[model samples]
Target: MVYKELTGTSVRLPANFTGKRFLTIIALNHAMESSKPVCSDGITRDISAALIRNVTLEHAAWTETVICQKGLPYLLQSNLQKVPLYNSTTCLSKCNLIAETTLADYFPATHISGSKDHDISDFICQFLPLYTNETLVYLPNDHIVLNWEVEESGSQVDDFYVGLGLDATEKDSPSLVDYISTDRKPYFKHRHEAIGSNELFYIFIKTVNKAGLSNIAILGPFLIDQTPPQYKYIPRVKISEESILFAWESDTFYDDEQTAEINQLAFQFGRLSCV
Candidate 1:
């Protein structure tokens, strides 16, 4: 699949996810209740959060020491004097060896994301994600605005596409999925998922700067409608931005297993979005 620019010509930077740290990997495992400790980077190892943090802290100190040694060469003057007989190339090689050794110990504990020999895990990194909150507001002029709260992740969120269909099976393709708008903004006003209740609807999202429709996320199998049954227009709250004031809520967020299932179904319609 080819990436068709739906917003504009310029490239938008992806959202930076907090899960970049080792702590996030631990959190993800805990959240998913997985026995195997692994990160999206494909590094699988049984490790504790405390150990990881300690290793990270140690690595930081060691790095600082290395920087200090580089800035103040005098710190190694005594050693250099003893090794005066050694050539400059030998000295440089020894320094490089020390750095490699020091890094080898602590790097594994922190940089467990992936290795050149290993492939990245999609389930932990790409598949398992947190859901963001959305707010619905009704203007006095009958204008409806959906404030979609984009959640933070280890990946970048490019754009979101809100689509309405008869069922999950309907409009399975990104091209077929009813898209209203595309942007980096968390809020969508012109078109949203809350359109009709007679059919199922969904939200399709894109993450990363990959080509085609491979990295797009499919969220939802909702029954959203503009005017809910006997729905009286409620005044918008001016307090917190957490509350959603939409006509009705969208049911795109699902359980882990169910979400995987829904996502699989959505991927089946990939042909529509892929070139």
Candidate 2:
């Protein structure tokens, strides 16, 4: 059957039909002209119908099943496709098929709409810069905690992938090779033993939405130092007639030496009573 109008039409089949039936839908841009005689010229012209460029086809199928005692109609499959309607004059671009959703053993009372209104640009604008800020805190036993605050208004986060690498500017694909995958959470714990001590590392957080769109947030060139400072040599004390001096040498990690500095010296003495 052919549907000429740009509106939906419902067709009922015979009750005796039991095999699978195929349906084809086509959307045309211009209305087809009738073959009736309009002009006095004896020449005949061929009229062709052009198809609309951006055409989307949506279909849903279901089957009735008798399980136990109740007969329920379960949704078999539902799909949305951007029909690739192209002619010799115009070449249409290819687009990835939007994600599909399957409902089993049940169907909604009303029609469910797809994300056709939400375009790629809208999706990026709403979900870009996934997090406002991130925090990394060091813990004992070569462990650390990472936390971040996500934007309140946007697509919900589906999963998070945490990556630790030496190169902060590395691309997402290679950096996330050895990563820890987790669900939607504000914080993630990672052990530093795998990276070793006295080395700089960067933490990358990748947030993914239900539609598979992703954004990456990078934090740090953090230096992992589990080692503590130690005294290089024993302190030397020199007592003079007018002054007392004390000196000592110590060894500390490079990162610690940059921040920890000795600014003051204190000496405590006890009073002696002479007979």
- What TM-score goes with each of the models? 0.24, 0.38
By TM-score, how accurate is candidate 1? 0.24
Considering every candidate listed, which one attains the maximal lDDT? Answer: 2
lDDT of 1 by residue, 115-155 (tens): 11112222222222211211111112212333333333233
Alpha carbon deviation, residue 245, candidate 1 (Å) = 35
Consecutive 10-residue window with the lowest summed lDDT within model 2: 88-97
lDDT of each: 0.28, 0.39
Q: lDDT tens string, model 2, 1-275?
A: 32334445654544343222344444444576434433333222212111111111112111111111022211112121111111111110111111221111112222224322334223322332211112122222346565555552335466777777677676375352366786766567765566655555566667675546666655444544454444445567799888987766543212352233332344555586322
The worst-scoring run of ten residues by lDDT in candidate 1 lies at: 54-63
Candidate 2, RMSD to the unseen true structure:
25.8
Off by over 4 Å in 2: 1-6, 9-141, 174-177, 236-275
The candidate scoring highest on TM-score is 2
Model 2 residue 186 lDDT? 55
